[model samples]
Target: MAFSQQLPQGVTDLYADDYELKQALTGQLQHVISSYGYQPIQTPTFEYYDLFMNVPGTMNSDQMIKLIDRDGKVLVLRPDATVPIARMVAQSQSEVETYNKFLYVTNIFRMESGESDRSSRSFSQVGVEWFDDAHPLNDIEMIVMAIESLKQSGLKNIQLELGQAGFFQSLLQEAGLTIEQQLVVQQKVDEKNEYELSRLLTQYQVNDQIKNQLIQLPSLFGSPNYVITEAEKIAVNRGMKQSLKRLVELVNQLEQLGYAHYISIDLGLVNHLNYYSGTMFQGYIEGYGKPIIQGGRYDQLTKYFDLETSAIGFGIYLDDLISIVKKQQSFKTNQLETVDVVTEEKDFVKAMEFAQELRGKGVVVNMHYENDSTTGDPVIYLSEKKVEIKGETFTFTTVEDFLTKAGFKNGNN
Candidate 1:
């Protein structure tokens, strides 16, 4: 309760520039997600704890922020969005029986140290879910949108790493490992711990061929064509062959769509087999400590809900993108030529009208009854006959002159 007390770790507070940057980017993300024809949907900030508890592919309870409701039912602040969306579709009783495409930009919560810190503990996640359509194009479109959205956000030097969970799944099925043993190897591989994988393969007496391929999997990444060629050599079973073929098809489609330059195959990925039923990928930008975006196909996730729907989706970590955008374009993120209008007591009426007019012309206007920016924000003060921007004041006898100089224009010139 003391002012000097600091907030929790992995959580953060956001102010003017930080907060505004996040909002504006969230809007941009919505535009990109919508353009793919994925209609928008929303889920609760918290839900019955059972919704995600022990969910095979979801994060563990230790990472989730949990509590009790008045009814005594356990509740969890939603840690992730994809699983919730899948649950929503399964529960929908729509009689039409048609395909569904959904998208949303919402806050995701996790336990952290701060009550006021809104950045790390609470994240703005924007993503899309295309259900009932299992075509490779659905997968391709999401990847393409990911690239465009990042580029649109002024982030350059992005690299997309692609892989197939099916390949690994096939390897496990052929290896005849129990669920417990399979999980052990999958975790080690997902973390790229080759030593543990080697140890497990020898301890479990895994076939020489399966062991060799599992060992080589993490290192098999490069040009799409090359990786597929390498995977083909080790793909001994029908499932492995099918997965290899699927990856080839995805690469061909990317090339046709002209996104091949951003494509590289990473055979090492071992996302929970329960999710990521097929192609999975992660996008990275320079300077970000983690992936800016990550998602994959989870066609079988619906099975848990008694629905056979096929789906693939991805989520954007808008917080990370904001950091990248801030460093890359601080001036732009500061908002478009901010104009704060202040008027004398008698001109409040005209000032309000002028503020609305500025907004109509696509400029951000801050209207204040007084002449000061309380938060130290750079302001443009508009008095009865003059406009003060920064420290320089300019006289304007006409509204048209004020509009033109402040970078606003009336329609029709």
Candidate 2:
């Protein structure tokens, strides 16, 4: 096997228009996030292995790419931004204010065991974390921002399905299921496999009342009004009731904001990350089967770092986003036009001067000696007294006259 010619599985190289379009999408999302007061921040590409290993629910250890440092400390490529950002916030708790907001566009590396071609071991994520604010309004703000960010990326027909992790967790506790049993049930519910979920609940010999509710979990999704009303009827315990109340508040507020049309409910929409302690949501664009955005409230994650702060955040799968945007042709790349300048050896210095001037005026200029093949829009033939553009030749007395004759208005074509 030739290592040089082959990229590792689940990785890819991006170039040309694809890369430019990805950048354009990222910029649009960043602008949206920043507009909401999220200041950009970055974490190292790798961190000590224990940083993640110690934090259960962050990610599976086996999925992490690891290495050993000189002193024999284990390190893993950063698999998640939220966890590390939480760690950073905790470490700087004394220095910074109690509340903070951060945004990031970073790469995440992890091993995907068995995934489709759409899955990449390395991918970029655009996300934001709001710290120390657990009010329902904060949750509303995050969801609103998520919708706006997706719209900014030129995605229409977007649907954000909201769920409550606490609601599901409360039901699990009432069912008295062991950790292993809980995982099996959670997977079935997350998949919306009601048949399997019913079989599992019956096998566990869960209480008749609780088992009935568990069986209906998969079907507990639709419009916010319908799901919420139905979920209230099954509210089995205090925790479940409280979680539902939070959902109600969020839905009411979102409706007032005129975003109810974009909102849906999914009581069974459980996130694989165990850190989520409250509302969990995912955004899907029409025609795309997988979610482009996912997030939730994980008020307890910072406690693992010895800080008691509430937080919520989401990551937009940039690779997936780029694919959808390209398919829709919704986003236009702000690619600059390149102009090629052709000149003789004796006039090279003059050509260089003219090229710099054009560049200063916001045009992309490429220099070429007359015989050199050029690859740019609008080739310019520069000599002592004549100028040529688009097969039309003319004589100009000054650079300003040349600019006017070439039809460069306001420093650009």
Structural similarity to truth (TM-score) of each candidate: 0.86, 0.93
The superposed Cα distance between candidate 2 and the true structure at residue 240, in angstroms, equals 1.1
lDDT of 1 at 237: 92
Backbone clash pairs for candidate 1 read 8-113, 8-114, 12-117
Query: Model 1, which residues run further than 4 Å from truth?
Result: 1-4, 95-99, 111-120, 330-384, 388-394, 405-407, 410-413
Tens digits of lDDT, candidate 2, 302-341 = 8899987899999999999998988898888776656677
lDDT of 1 by residue, 107-190 (tens): 898764443223377787888888856888788887898888887777878888898988999888877898889888888887
| lDDT, residue 32, candidate 1 | 73
Tell me the TM-score of model 2: 0.93
Scored against the true structure, residue 54 in model 1 reaches a CA lDDT of 45
